[model samples]
Target: MPIRARGARHRTGPLRSPGFLRSLVFAAVAALAAVLPAPVGAQAAARPTESRPIYSYESAVREAVWVDTGLDADGDGRGDRVAVDIVRPREPAQQGRKVPVIMDASPYYSCCGRGNESQLKTYDAKGDVVQMPLFYDNYFVPRGYAFVGVDLAGTNRSDGCVDVGGRSDVLSAKAVIDWLNGRARAYTSRTGTERATAGWTNGRTGMIGKSWDGTIANGVAATGVEGLKTIVPISSISSWYDYYFAKGAPLYDGGPAELADAVESPDAQAHCAAARQKLVDGSPRSGDWTQLWNDRDYVLRADHVKASVFVVHGMQDLNVRTKNFGQWWDALAANGVERKIWLSQTGHVDPFDYRRDAWVPVLHQWFDHYLLGYDNGIERRPMADIERHPDQWSTDRVWPPSGTSAATVHPVNGPVPGVGALSASPAPAGTASTFTDNPALDESSWAANIDKSTPDKAGFATAPLTKDLRVSGSSRVSVTVTPTTSSAHLSAVLVDVGPDTIRNYAGEGEGILTGTDRTCWGVSTAGDSSCYLTTSADKADVGFTVFSRGWADLGNYASDRKGVPLTPGKAYTITLDLAATDHVVPAGHRLALIVAGTDNGLIDPPPSRPTLTLDLARSGARVPFVGGAGAFARATSGARPNVAAGVPDGTPSSPGIPVPRMAAQRLPGGAGR
Candidate 1:
């Protein structure tokens, strides 16, 4: 259930550290260059010419391949290379012509002799071609722009090691940009004017993609690279530790194993299998939490990024959590950089569906505004544009802005507001909920089926909304939990349950489900229930938690049979922080808080059924709200009038918890109109 792209095949054997590929590229480039001939007057006649090769397009869609040459700074042998794919009007703009460039730096072998044809043939679940096809070029390319897919070093035919997250990746990206600009200059010289410019040569470049590619786009932007006008980093993490490891705990258990099992190639499978074994063997070199933090530069400090950004996350993404999006958003806001975010209800792969309709166009518009300098109304857009339950899009100037208040929803036995506080006492002694970790259940059972028959799951609901409420930011629940054993995992989910039916808004179709909108809005449409919305499963979200390891360590507290006896009558508080989102709770709808001993389908079921105790007094739930009294009054009445409006526009009210300045607000009388 975690958002994961289908794995690519490994060519030969287990992937040694990328250090070996670096050596290979260096050797191959040198050997090839040595045998090639030097052209006469090659140095004196250093002029740019349009090196046209094959080109094709149907209707407005266009696809072309051209070769660019430059000095190889790394001395790996091959000339600095640039292969660009252009799709747009053949004629230059009547005025100042500048086309935006959406650069996709592919780790798959996109260059070399394999070409685009070979890449598209690969298939994932659903039998549809898994890889992005060149025929798929029309989506963004034809919209008066160009899409450049760069084959990262050593992958296609490019030289150097395919460093995952090292210096090479950054330098190689810069090198590509330089080559592209040079190509534009050459074309201009040949045409006797700066008429035909390709890629980001004459304009700006915006990075966009999902999974590994998406992560790389962010990595490059973090370098503070110039010309990176803006970026749409979808379903990616800025920090590896927060992503691959959980609170310094290795993520090698259920989720990781399921991902490993999906790889079809013997080589790729062997590598993951080996890594898994090493983890099981407790090998020192297996790269644990400390090792990963030391080995990879995952943290994306606010001061490091120079480009404006639009981050997308999914609420139900079992792989990467909305928390990662919050981390990046907070860092940028703290740095005072222009930023926007979109939280979708779908999972990692669901966003890629052309049928979904909203996100793809938004991505194109983002690039159009930044790369092509088009006044496509992107700048006027809000900092966060999210779609809440049912279906709708809402915009806001800032994210979880100041003035939001935290309102606690506690379970009580008495009447409405005056019901008086439920006894500030723990559950009766010896009372607990127990469930077993059935091995027969598929790993994805938690997120796949939504019949409400799952035994290990528990649900709590809030009274119908008294007023229009926007629950944004992270949602937390404090429960007194004691695992039957010293070492056990606890999982929780915050769901928006309907009055009559249970809806699975976070589920998605086959393939990688990128949780972009769900991460920001936290709610999903009725039919789109394939994605799972929770932050406990993803490392990115946990990294954003306000509390440190001390707050998250439940410690095998539930290791006994009486189901981790709750301190007899004492109340212990366990926090279940749901994924972040901006959603509006209509006056009629109720919000459900779901807590489960296991992450059902997303992660491996618990080793055994553990008993957990609910201490409602010390344990309570807090949601982000925008309007109320005192401090939040201004935000609600002055800016967020929607809180008083009856209609829902997808944007959820802030939980009102003061989490710095990233809270939501509305203009008087609804400025959006």
Candidate 2:
């Protein structure tokens, strides 16, 4: 019953009992534990494995370092220093194992917070990060990865002026990536002379975030930073010009300067005043193309992107607008960058809140494959995951689906005298419709009673569809108009004219309903909880919905760079690109198009009001159909004369879309998230 040691004399007395053998084994384990690094938090220090956790979450190391950017945005005479808070597995670095970095460089860490809970980073007396705001650090650190939360220049703990997506904002994050790859310098303290290096990293990095944070990811990727392996930009901007203007039409009165002022910290405001003024002087409200806009336009530099891109956006996000992701996605495709995309129907909402069940694992696989060099084959899978309805998602081998093609539809005279019919064939020669420009009425006002004639807008509708028709991508309107004034503003909207239950974006919740119940994503600590409020779809029943919309300045019809007033009453042709969309017009539902002027809250109006006469024979819309023209033709084989009859009288309310980056401006001076 007693265990005997090799070559040792047979044990006598108490050593012969089984309890004594057990005591000896227990004592040996205790001796080994004392000599080795104490087992992490009540359990043995986890060892790296092909699958499962490799380290202890409780023992992850937390530290702060200030990365020095070469730019002097605040005119402080010294290069800007961006505060980078890092969380990594302590055992890996101690064991001489290097891990990849998952970074989120943002201007919102202290200003607006992050995620549904509106969490801010918490630190201890030593100024080391004790708790991070989001689940990135909690979920990935134990899995053999490092998470870095960076405060962009001029925000939070960083020292510089907020450039609002300009060079300073972009390069501040780039400097961190450069430091990881040994190309830039960092210090343990903000003003410390001593240098620090990222000896724990493998020199591979991935940047990710939502809104302004995500926009920084796009800007940094455009610089072609070598160590950045990929980026996941959600509801982000590709061009700051597009953020404030659309086709030579200003979307808002405030430009980059206002946004900069909104996010700059109180202590930094005086230092940032000159930088903010530069933003105002460089970005003219006249919508002229300038070097300033070129510096913030990432789409122009898509070819410079070597990092793989994972794009996520809401189709109904009027704040950032769908065009931002659409143009950026197209540019990335043209450059042959490895990419994936997720498109949702919600307005300005993050996928984590809407599709957390699926988003987390997909994101994990993406990072593991791209950042950690895992052979997970995520790149070989389908490229798109599209949310067609609330809680309903579908995957496609390619975005816009494979068979998408343009199908031309024109407006012709309907049975109702003034109401126009959208037909597959062009209208009769010499036919024309006229409407006066009204700056007061927006797309919502014109969307109502679309089957009836209105003085301010021209409405055209298709007959009740005999079969389901889907518009897969962006739509275009090429119209030849003769205006009564020298300059005019133009707007186009594609509407799904049918009763349906959709996300209640018009409500306070925007598109999702947050509940009292909470769900946890990762490990939790006293200062930070990985748990967050649960969310469900908030539905609203509506008679009709505006699925796609676009705006342009008639004076800038010839070029987006400059506006040249047209001769009154002379015909000029211009093509307007509708926002990219993927929507299904169900069988028995009608598809309608509305043409108007000055979409109120969306873009600034021109000084003159124009009554434009449209040449119907030369005016038509090119809609992206899933199966091209033939399928569209088959869906509407016979044109019904009165397409507008029997449609719902009630109109949908304005979808309460949030202002872009408004959440990030949650502080005293901020406005958008």
Candidate 3:
């Protein structure tokens, strides 16, 4: 094996892109203010003379209004607009306190709502906002802050087509920011009649949200908008393409436009039918990168990000995927952007749902430190706050930690070509691994019986570890192979082959289950509830779960965007990247690499299935295992139906990738340390 190693430490966060760039020259120029303040950084640390709370929770002015987006997305000949529902302190203006703002711009307001319960927004008879989902308004309003809920254009009262991450979606909320700082214009009606402005704001603002809402924040901040002091995007999509595609593989046979339709309004779907058709037309089904996707990709424009980023993401989030964060995080770091990250084991969940007690106050301090410009000393803290175990978190100076190194494991051909050992030592020359593509087998079924031979897939394993191994970052697999067909889709998955242990994720819960009881960390109001369902994730041993997986279409070996089909009898070298991860493999555990021609469980099977012949002599995998060995040395010391049958994490089925069945399901009792 021609093994190579790299041990560089780096930071991680979160993603952003597209056609909007063509209209960039005509884009709006002004940034906005929020929290109706005197001026940014005015009264550094002075206390108010007023006896009442500057931000009175009981007396907040709850109002609903519209902001002119200045675009006719539906060809209605009228400017598209967005609805801004606000709840702010009634006493701030009198206290001479121009408060900074915290805003949540979401598309879920009228659809799925927010939080674990999916609470939607409610309004009064006069069309004024009566209810705003989540505890943001209820908690922050009393603390001298304004909580603004904005309905993205085409959803709720906002007017326009749902172009996904296109102009309509981005500019609607941006117009609200403009209205605050006096940069752009807004109106009181969807008819473009009455004008409106933010006479009650301080101009400086910070955006906070989870999932799609968080994605919007990331997209807007990437526009280099001024007054956007910071953004807290949790488990959000940085690239819609990344959201729907993996290494050129489409998710559920749908592309970006289909996703746009998923979130689009039913009434507007027909109105935007032409636009939707254009979306489908522009998005290439061949998996080639297009300007359309580029226009919507925030990561491509990350260099323009001026706002400090406080990112929160579940590392196990298969929905949005950590790739969205890790890739964008790298770009932001390369551009020297200031950032902080919270990497949780939970999948697609808010920190409030994961870590309730510490999340709110920590968030408060973060917003105060940036939006309020208060000397909260939050910047003095570590760069990363990572969850080491369920309900157990610790801070670190940097992510991927410091004392980490990379290692490469090669395929060791033996009894048969496709059957082998993964090691640091070189395999004999002319060795090969062959498997015809099969869509039926999953990661578990293919790898579970390594002792038995199968023609559908290939399996390789390393000797038991002699010391504890910690892998932190993305892993890669490159192979020299010959295919029997022009096109081939290969799935490479990294699996942890080990004894029964406490799995971090049992069905996306991160070993934490939502219970019936409720816990109120903060005060709640009628409209905004602070009480959330509690979590119950025990430190119990469970089954084997996929560590990370990556896929590649053989036709795209030359470029991720373009495809060059292989000649039936010729050899080609293809490389696939496993998901970025930070996992600890115990000394007695084994590491396995499973490769197959197709993962029908995750994607649609191509019309033609191809048989692949891998030259094991040239095939190898590189693991960014932090502090591992120079060789795959031998160990000195050394599941059930659905795999997580009695594991008890409360998650229904495994999310993203399913756990390997019979890997290690049944577990006896052991108290959590």
Q: Report each candidate's C-alpha RMSD, comma-separated, in the order given.
A: 16.9, 9.4, 11.7
Ranking by lDDT: 2, 3, 1
Candidate 1, which ten residues in sequence have the lowest lDDT sum?
664-673
Cα lDDT tens digits, model 2, 48-88, are 11222335667788899999999888887898899999998
Runs of candidate 1 with Cα error greater than 4 angstroms are 1-100, 108-144, 153-175, 178-200, 241-288, 291-299, 349-364, 389-391, 401-403, 411-459, 500-553, 556-576, 605-609, 614-617, 628-673
TM-score quality measure for candidate 1: 0.57
Best by TM-score: 2
Candidate 2 deviant stretches above 4 angstroms: 1-51, 643-672
Q: What is the C-alpha local distance difference test score of each model?
A: 0.42, 0.79, 0.68
Q: Model 3, range 1-673, lDDT digits (tens) per residue?
A: 0011110001010000133332222211111122234455764433221111123465677877788778888887777778898888776666565666889988777766677777788987877677788777766665667788988887777777777776677777777787778887776666667777677787888998887788888899888887788899888778877765666766446555665565566656767778787788877777777777787799988998998898887766655667778777878888988888888776667888777667776787777778766565677778888776676676777766776566778877644445566667667788787899887777656656443458987887655566666677778898888989888888887766654434355353545677987765434556555566787653444334466777777787888777766788898888886777766655655667788877655554665788898888888888876554432343313301112232111121222335322222111000010
What stretches of model 3 exceed 4 Å from their correct place? Answer: 1-54, 414-418, 450-452, 500-512, 538-541, 628-673
TM-scores for candidates 1 onward, in order: 0.57, 0.88, 0.84
Per-residue error (Å), model 2, residue 179: 0.4
Q: Which is better, 1 or 2, measured by lDDT?
A: 2
